[model samples]
Target: MLRLSQFIFKETRERLGTLSFLINSIKFVTLAVFRILKGLFMNGTKVFNKEKIMQQNNTYVLIMAGGVGSRFWPKSRNHFPKQFIDILGTGQSLLQMTYARFLQICPKENIYILSNQDYKGLVMAQLDGIAASNILLEPSRNNTAPCIAYATYKILQQNPEANIVVAPSDHLILKETAFLDKITQALEYTSKNEALLTLGISPTRPDTGYGYIHFEQEAVAGVHEVNRFMEKPVLKKAKEYLASGDYLWNAGIFIWSAKSIQKAFQTHAPEIAKLFEQGNSVYNTSEELGFIQENYPNSPNISIDYAILEKATNVFTIPADIGWSDLGTWASLHEVLPKDASNNSKSTDHLHLEATSNCIIHLPSGKAAVIKGLDDFIIVDDEKVLLIYPKSSEQEIKSVAGAMVATYGKEYL
Candidate 1:
């Protein structure tokens, strides 16, 4: 009996020891996994959690569609801006494409378009199923500062902890996966810190048309501190900037918390901040239009860069190589559109050209045209109006459009 009891006791002890080892092994593996997950999320290497990272419930998007796109005229008119047209020939308007891109970042209800009150119908027609309230109409053309303030403050009222991505409606992004990743990175950083972050496109050329962002060696999780902002530079300065390697083209894509941006406005431009604050009570309500109509235009006319981004001390930028183009000019549009071996972009096959190189021809579908001996030109035919101008003189197109409006009538425009 004593031997049998010893045998049983030894067997029980060995089983307990094996069980202990298994538990310890499990605990070690779990700890390692937890740390790995924490590191991945902290470094922005991976997205976790449904609310913050996966579904992005707290993320909101603001699409700036108020611009008249005067540079793209005869094709882009005051009544019907370029944002509403299928400039890319992809059957999707720029506004529609922009809105669709944001949907992948946030909920459909969280998207907002800040456009002139005149374009509300166009906005609705393009973005079907979007809630009418989601369209934030600007009472007047007060530029970006006022509309941004209005939209940010209004979003704050709805979700005080909102993370907003402000983007132009007319830009084109070819590498969407890379672009979304950068936006997610910026959004993640803003969620944890009180930093105003913007994406800076790595410059591929010394182009003078884009604003440049100067960043310092200081960086946090891939975002660098912005040293200063430079407006469109001359060719010489642009080359210098490209050589320095510290400059990035300002993409105007910003990500920030509503609280953070609101604080910046309050700190830098108290008047603009106060102007929108008064309407907090009426925002998201039926009385909002009346309040905006009466008070929005009263706000100062200033760009967001001048109003807050330039003045804010906590500005940061993430250098990204995502294929981005503001599509600010016809020449810019030509660069991205599919081209032929001769370096010409034509929207329709009806256009037949001979000895033409470096030209862009846009015309209505099924409208046939034949041209010869033209190089580096823009030919656009939009019912009742035709524009054929040299690409080198495209910079003056804006003033030319205004002159046409004055000489002829707004009807032609």
Candidate 2:
């Protein structure tokens, strides 16, 4: 081992003699040896899978992945939504990434997925080791209120004192350590208090796509009371909210105790509460399917924000700078991805381009593409359908997808 280490240092120093180069070379060699040792001793287990804090078996995760992601059409289809796709070019899909992120907080068996019944096969194929029963299948896409109601009620049956974190399967969080730290903090707070907490991202821009959250100036235990929830506003209103310094981009990530949220539903969304309450005995049993199928659609179609958080006085916000993105549209994806000198982001290296700037291109592997004289545009070529549209008007892609479904067929979408 000493001989091998000396040989590496000698070769590195001979090739690059500068002081900085020698330091970097030593660091690289050290990292390589460390990785080898860790692989041998640890058997490739991840850093976050430690047993220290994950013993909080009362902590649970509910990943909401029911949306169609229509704005990212051609790539994100109805049958194959964004959550099941590796839109970031990462090996793991978004749903897999989300599940892995929560392994630091809770045990594998503690995690659950809230998704439409149609994506059952896709969800199972993407996420390994999750219980088939843990995948709470929604009979219909009744939005988030019904979705949360079912999961909250169901988890209550298994563990009446569970504290849960609800996150979207498709959102991207770049700063994992900080994000997890915030999650740990939120879980700590929720385990103790009756407050309903949402992780609010500090806005980097006046983004009009996301809903804005108005919060109080004071904080208790690093969380502030939410004054109100604002709808997606116009450009002028978004800019005003950004300038105010009292607003955050509502990230839709929520944290609460099972008992706290259950009570909120009973008080604010009584109908939804009563509807899901009937499944108390059947939540974790063989009768869950029959119970949900018959009763889920009867609940009102509403968002948790509108139904509970907006009305509940216990709503709180954790202002976090976690480098988050909803990845809602092609424009949003472009901003998060790496760009070239010309500011063009491409998923495939097979693209030949000239004078093309401020564009996002995604193509299947090994598919060569050549383009010229394009600016501020989205170019996505899924094997079946290709889309080329202006980045400024990317919001219209949802309507365009609906048009395609109307003209051609659902198969194309």
Q: Which pairs in model 2 have colliding backbones?
A: none
Point out where model 2 deviates above 4 Å.
1-53
RMSD of each candidate?
Answer: 17.7, 7.8
Q: What's the CA error at residue 207 for candidate 2, in Å?
A: 1.5
What TM-score fits each model? 0.87, 0.87
Among all windows of ten consecutive residues in candidate 1, which has the lowest summed lDDT?
25-34
- Candidate 2, residue 34: lDDT: 32
Residue-level lDDT of model 2, residues 1-413, one tens digit each, is 33443454465557767675535522254444333433443443223333534775788889998889888898999889999988876666888988888877778788889999899999888887678988988898889999899999999988998999999999887666667777877888888899999999999789889999999989988899999999999999999999999999999999999999999999999999999999998888889999999999898999998899889999898998766889988988887565556778777667799999989998887689999999999999998899999998988888888898899988978
lDDT of 1 by residue, 189-290 (tens): 999999999999999999999999999867779999999999999999999999999999999999999999999999999999999999999998889889
What's the C-alpha lDDT at position 138 in model 1? 81
Distance from true location, Cα of 306 in model 1, Å: 0.7
Highest-lDDT candidate: 1
